[model samples]
Target: MAENTKIEWCDHTFNPWMGCTKVSPGCAHCYAETRMDKRLHKVRWGKGQPRQRTGVANWKLPLKWDGEAQKATGAFDESFFNQAKLSQKRPRVFCASLADWLDHEVPTQWRVDLLNLIEQTHNLDWLLLSKRPESWSARLHEAMGGGSELARRWLNGEPPANIWVGTTVENQLLADERIPALLRIPANVRFLSCEPLLGPVNLSAIPTGEGHGLNEAFPRITMNPLRRALRDAPHVHWVITGGESGPNARPMHQDWARSLRDQCAAASVPFLFKQWGEWRPADDRDSDRPHWVGIPDGSEEDFSDSPMVRVGKKAAGRLLDAVEHNEFPQP
Candidate 1:
């Protein structure tokens, strides 16, 4: 778990599980996959313990925090949980950056454990983002099915107050499939992560039908036709935007991010711009020489004279034309 993440959208990151199998086009540059492959190779050499193909290992366990003691003991305590609690001045924490908390491969007991941990650490808000919100929707349905007492106790009205649930919307297909599923979760604070922006996603396409099987489980958003359609669909309080990173990183054009920033502003939702990623527009690309060098690579042409499309997060990363570090919405 990274107590402080350089990824500006998330205040911190916690990984209950560290490995994942790719499930979509967005998974092509998955950071988790890269790390897992490295660890697996090491394990094979006996440098590290072997991992169960299906179960989460000790290293994959979610970091647990003890807030009650931390409140009483002050910040200097050496206890792990206390240290994490003291370190966070921000409101929300991103849970499981390397793995999906709702991944079917992770046992239900582990989910319960994670939820319980979230419940206990009430002071620190939790953001649970998943590419597989449908899996969580199914589990929530099952819990509600048997009229189980435990389920009733835990998931009666909506998700825990301290936890915000969100789903990744990489492209249109995934946005259609996963966002609706996310709308069904009982969490009070629901949001969207359109990070590693892959394509131009029009949020208006989200379904807003009534009596959709999962509608009652999660309330819909109401306002404009697009917002109203999504109203009662699932309430998205915040939006985090970013471009891809790492070698072979995809270039996210400036227009794509600006469109989202504009939409979020119109909707009155908080917008966060995370990074520029690896590539930028030809004009914005850093040059070794001064402008007086006059396009050293070739002609005496001005690079800035080209069409104004900025690539990479740094050039396009500005949110509402300014850097905005938003506080987490109330849980």
Candidate 2:
């Protein structure tokens, strides 16, 4: 768990466990998977042994964060949350930074326990994102309230108000496949992360703002929500876009990010441009460059950074065409 983090969207990073399989292209240069191979050598990456949970201290962090956040909001005691006496501030928690909560391999009991913790932490907004939407219906439904959906149904939404569920989409396929499934659940807030983005994702239907453009082309994905309160209000409340980081990072096309920005803007969804990954728009040059190089076009050159330069995540920054899109869903 993190008390301080560099990820702009959320506050703390809580890890229920640390491991997962490489099921999609977004998993190509997965920082978590790579770290498993290098840093946490005791645990291996892949299907059989993806990762293990940390000690209980790490597990109880959200409670501590909730209390502190409540104290800051002048909600110092059990008065807690009522119409007029609610805590002024709620700390945002990015749950499972190192593992997918939806991963079928993670014991159902772990998820049930984690859900219990989330319920106890009254003043924290938990963000539980996953790459495995395919497993959501089965795993989530199965783990409901001591293996019974009764307690979950007692609440209006399946998850409590503090929890915001999301799915990761690196390309069109995931966006298409996952969006509909995600929409089927009334998770309060639903979002999409297009990091390590791999190709043209026509998220004209389900919308998020950004992620890395892809290395190879794939069939485009098309999807929609069950409905947006009669198709008027925003369905996908938030969108985060960025490029790949690390040594083998890939470049995201400017147009790809721009297209998403436009889509989010149209849908009235909050759009956050995370970063340009290891690539940035090429600066003006005296000599002409190849069509494949210099700031990418998402085509021509997939490997070499012709016009785009390897400026790294820091230097490249999170600006899309020099504009920093730091939108978030209103809490």
Candidate 3:
């Protein structure tokens, strides 16, 4: 992972570790897993070992920083807090795009190092996304050990102000299981990522209230399903919506994407439409070929240098509409 990435929704990507096991349907066609298996074979072999392609130990490389802000001092420094260029400024850094920072397989010490990086980079907003938000929450509490100053700081509302905790909600089942766990983590910003979206999810249908049995004297806090159910849950401020891409990319209906966009608009949340995946729309349900041929509009005209493609062909990354500018959280 690096400071520069073409992913439209974020300013940069940072992965302190590499490799992960699939935890949900969203991992069906993970681009990162494929890249790790095919391209960086040797890095998967062991720790501190040099891969065939790169002579140096891959772990020793400096965390990719886009600007010439100089190296970070100690584990936590102001340099790490510097912002990216305005043209490239999306503010939110996609933490662990290639690996799960909170994966159980990762050493606890490594997680501390990653958290240190997050704390150090205070100026740039950090977006921590995971399919295993529960594991992350558990590990975090364990690391802080019940209630230390560090734990108190996080629990007492000093959880790296730049960090936003989120979880992936691909289908209703996963949404039901994971969203609640995501809400339990204490972070400055809380939101959700429903991209590579596999099925429709209705957040309104979720149950809201205190879990089964607790002291009745607890004020009967009518636990706002959207807030209490989601730890310190605030109104969702940002949403990224996109369909799958690649040969086996699933078809996403225009209505589904539009519905979420509309919901976000109604709630005053910023919405970003990333792309239409490989399978295009066919007039008849049985038609083998896409009916509205040519790439989706708003997608880059040149496919030669684009990283995203559809069904082994260059996708213009267009939307149902004939426009090309789908970037969101607009300035």
For candidate 1, what's the RMSD? 8.6
Query: Tens digit of lDDT per residue, candidate 3, span 63-157?
Result: 34412223322243444333331223425578777776667666665666556655554445667888888786467765566333344477555
- 1-331: candidate 1 lDDT, tens digit per residue: 4456665655567765455566776777777666565545421211133322333443233233335334644543335433343233424578877777766655565565566556556456678888888787566545445443334554566455556788887766677777767666766567788866776666765663445666567655322322532455456777777767766566555566777777776776666666656544444454542322123111123334323333435554444345554533431
Ranking of models by TM-score: 2, 3, 1
Q: Which stretches of candidate 1 lie above 4 Å from their native place?
A: 39-90, 141-151, 213-233, 284-331
- Evaluation by TM-score, superior candidate among 1 and 3: 3
Q: For residues 1-331, write the lDDT of model 2, one tens digit per residue.
A: 4456678887789888878787887877778767766676746778987468778888877788877876777654454443322122566788776678888888778777887787777677788888886666677676774554433662335455667778887777688777766665566678888787666677656542222145235433433442352365336777888888998877887777887888777667788999988877676752353332433222333534435667668988988877899987764
Specify the highest-TM-score model's number: 2
**Looking at model 2, which ten-residue stretch has the lowest summed lDDT?**
207-216
The all-Cα superposition gives candidate 2 an RMSD in Å to the true structure of 6.7
Stretches > 4 Å off in candidate 2: 76-88, 145-151, 154-157, 205-234, 285-306
Candidate lDDT scores, in order, read: 0.58, 0.69, 0.56
What alpha-carbon RMSD in Å does predicted model 3 have with respect to the real structure? 8.3
TM-score of each: 0.70, 0.82, 0.71
2 versus 3: better TM-score goes to: 2
State residue 118's C-alpha deviation in candidate 1, in Å.
1.4
